[model samples]
Target: MKSLLVVSIVFVLIIIQGTTIGGTRFPTSDENSNEEYTYVEYEEEESSEESTLPPIPTTTSRVILSTELETEGPTIANEFECPTNCKCNKKITLVDCSHQNLMQIPKNLPQSTVYLNLSHNSLKTLNVNDLINCGELRQLYLNNNEIGKIVNTEDFAKLPNLHHIDLSTNAFKPLQGKEFSKARGLLTLILTDNKDIVTSNVPIIQTEKLKTLYLANCSINQLPENIFQNLSSLVALNLDNNPLNLTQGVSAFKPLTELRRLFIPTVPRHIALNLCKNLQVIDIINLSLENHDISCFLLFNNATYEESTIRTDLFKTPTDPPSNSSIVVSTTAPTLSTHIQKGTEVLKQYANAAANQAKTTYEKMSMMYMILSGLVVVLLVAILSVFCIIGSRQLGREISYRKQNYRKYSAGNVTVENPNYERYLIECEKRQFTNE
Candidate 1:
């Protein structure tokens, strides 16, 4: 009878220890504490209303502990359905759990999800464990969430197939070493608009296949020289709006021989000439050159140099393109093309201005010539008027002299009484005067 009572007491102690601490503190199973506490267990009967509904299969179950211990919450399973407020596709994949004013990550996302968009939320932090089950996820959009830190790098590395990750508009500080070293297959990583980023915080990115990296508006002052040494496959690197004074840090791009497109800050004349040698597209953010220097800078692009080559798209297309098309596409880097286009634009602007100025000068010269021609015509007309006045005075004098001579000759002549007698008298007088 005593042995039976002892066994019953031990069994009761086991049950008491098995109960988890909900609101009140309880002794652990192995802990040897002198304090004794009373324990109680309550089981709820299945409601007939819930039983009438069809049963849902569960693949995995996790217990969620809440601060309030009033009642135990329901079990979360792997085959969890979409949340009431969120939208999902018919195949139960591609969940859009954004703008829900959620403070925590949503539970029970479908395992077959390829894309998960959780942008524009009020989340403060992220744990890798929350996303461990999403192995097939390729793109994860977590931009505009107030996430300050991401704990557990291992959880992120578990997703081998994840290619694109957007963590823009967050509150992240500098990252640690190889922050995403496990994401070997990652192709693109965007961390734009996180103003607290520092160069050291940029993880030692070890991915050889990483192609594009965007760090715009991250307050990055400078980049470590060797930060991109391992990224042999990188094609595009956007550092727009950062304060990287390229004059002091041109070596930052020495290792990026395969890089095709680059977006940088204000580039000095010497630096721009050298830096733009290999790049296809250079989207400069804040240009600080003078107007005269702008012409000089653009003219420098005419200098020819060796250009870097690019890789072709290995992923096969749905329809077969031409045989040599892929090879031609890969090797054709726009390095020279972009420079020619940009230089052409700058030169074209200057050409248009020069043409307009020439037109204006021609118009001014035409007006001056017209004024001079008018003056010359006025001078010629004044000289001709003066000569005509002098000639008219001379002619008047000659007429007066001729009139006097004619009057004297008429007075000397005698008047005849008869026409025949006057003629005989004039002839006799003229003959006598001539003989005298």
Candidate 2:
């Protein structure tokens, strides 16, 4: 009997387990029947020069084109007038003068050449005389070369259409502001791995239209306040792996309002968090704030702030008025530490904005207080003056009434309490009759 009962319980348990395991799933499940949901993100305008600078590169001092970053393409015929020991494309447009190991720039380059790859050579200083013929050049690659510096600003000016330049992995001296001043339409510049250019301050990036700039591994420890003031249109910037003091000031990057991507990894988690808090553009895909993704939070917060600012401009027009309550989502809620840091940063910004608002509030309050105080004083003085006038008039009337009563008393009284008028007249009339 016991064996039979145990068998019965075991059979029941197995049936229950099987039902729980496979009952929820449909036997004829069509996986494609599930509806898919997608978010239609607002499409931003495409970059103006996607050809000049590729999407934020991860490698440094390495040519994007590989030795041209020239790995020996098809060798053009001499009929195309290609320079000796150099290779040119079929159309004589993309010239590859790399790996020849010549001391100076090659002569007799094609006039119509646009892309010039002079990298991986032993050329020392780039003289203006060599690049005079390449006027139509657009992209110049001189990375991994011993060339220290270009001759002067006029050399870049000669190439009016020059857009992209890579001078990475070279020995360059401290660059003054005038290095690329004349390159007006310049778009992308790569100066990575050049240690000597970071002596006092960063080379003044004089190119106003510059969109992308790479200054990684240059040991740049200090950043001036207005270093990036003129780079308003810059879209992408890389300053990673450098010994920079990011706590110096956030104003250095303030002018880069149009900036979309940044690569700055400071040591210690809190420092990086603080810097990230101050900086507005931080790509979470490239950086990890304690392994927390703040992209959603930043995007939501930025969108909210921008929408609020526009609304304020359209509805409430004031010449630089401070916003009172604009924090929509509190930046984000990534993790405990990030949330705390973000909260602290929000507090700091609120403190600053509140201070401005408090100043105006305080000023208005003080003015109201003074006006009320002055009104009270005037009212008190008027009340006192009215009482004084009323008291003087009452005193004068009392004095005149007392004098009039005294004159009447003098006429009527012989002693202190006198007599009646009609009785005296009757007595005078009786005395006159007795004398007659």
Candidate 3:
């Protein structure tokens, strides 16, 4: 009976231990004399099977710990946490963190980000070293920022894949020395609206792939003779709103063979035409043409004979009598009036004859063009027919020869015959001397 009671007690203890903390033993404090408290250490046996079980979720612990941290929320200037009320769709790979009153870049950003927009921010300076981990970042917009100067050119050179950049409206006064040489794949650059940025001595000549460049409103007074000599692939350039006065003989833009757009405002139409000879469009608003020749309008009202300096000797003279003969010819007034009327009718007949001549000339030119077009079509057809006939004859001869050769080889049982065989073949025979 005692043994049965002992087995029951052991089974109850096993069930109690297994019921709490995944079978981990609970420690009891020892209350001995003068001692405040002491924990009873119990070394629980680690089951190999227990280790195979799925890990317990620690989310509850994390939530309890976070509650204890007493974090209110993200503040305006805080760079660690996302701003409150900002909808951050976790699925988007490019975050528009621009114009958000962010004094610094947010920390712990997702590593999958390939584009980051920090433009129109209060960031005074950017440490490019911080972005070395973002190797996949291809585009970065830093325009309208308070960036004063570039500290290290090598910082941006490390981003090998960065292609497009917009650093306009910054305080980069005078760019210097291979600043963009590292961005080998950079195709477009916009540095416009930086009023104090005078000279761009950046070694952009090494960036052969650069195509579009915008340097408008940079306070540039003039462009160097070889300013664009290295950008062979440049297609568009915006130099508008500058104080540049290009000289008449200055061919500084001759090297830009692929340049399509050259923006220069307030330039004379004639000068614009000459400066951009290959240009398809020119935007010359508010042009001042004070000394432009106005002789073209003067000849608009001049007679054709006077314009061409033609002789008037062949033109018909008026048959009307002189004014002084009116008084003396009063006795013959009826006869004089009849002569005047006849002269007026003769002039009208001459005008009608000239109009008919002009109409005939127009019809003749139209008929000539029609005849020429027909002749050209006929000539082209004849040439095409001749080539077709020659090609057909050559093809027929080749087909016949191929068939004859194919039959001979097939009959000898040396080669297999194919119904669709259309290729040429050559056979060689060995020379041997027979001895009798």
Best of the two (2, 3) by lDDT: 2
**Candidate 1: worst-modelled 10 consecutive residues by lDDT:** 55-64
Roughly what TM-score does model 2 have, to 2 decimal places? 0.52
Model 2 per-residue lDDT tens digits across residues 1-436:
6445544554454344333222221111112212221111111222354433234432232333322222233345534467777766566766777777878888767787777778878888877668868887777778767878777567777887777787877888877767888887677788877876754455467777888787776767877876776787787777755666766655577677667656553333334444445456533312211112223233334422212110111222355334332323333333333333443454456568989999999999999999999999999999999999999999989866554443233434553322444455677799999999
**TM-score winner:** 2
lDDT of 3 by residue, 342-376 (tens): 33344345557778988998899999999999999
Note the residue pairs that clash in candidate 3. Answer: none
Which regions of candidate 2 fall more than 4 Å away from where they truly are? 1-54, 57-80, 201-203, 267-285, 288-436
Which of 1 and 3 is ahead in TM-score? Answer: 1
TM-score of each: 0.47, 0.52, 0.43
lDDT of 1 by residue, 1-436 (tens): 6445544554453233222111111111122212221111111212222222111111111111112222112323345456545655555445566667878787755677666667778988887678877787766777678888877777777787777776777888666546677777676777777876655524446675676777766877777766676776676666756767666556667677666445454455455566654343332212211111112244344633222211112222456333332112223333434534554455566668899999999999999999999999999999999999999999989866554433232224763233344455677799999999
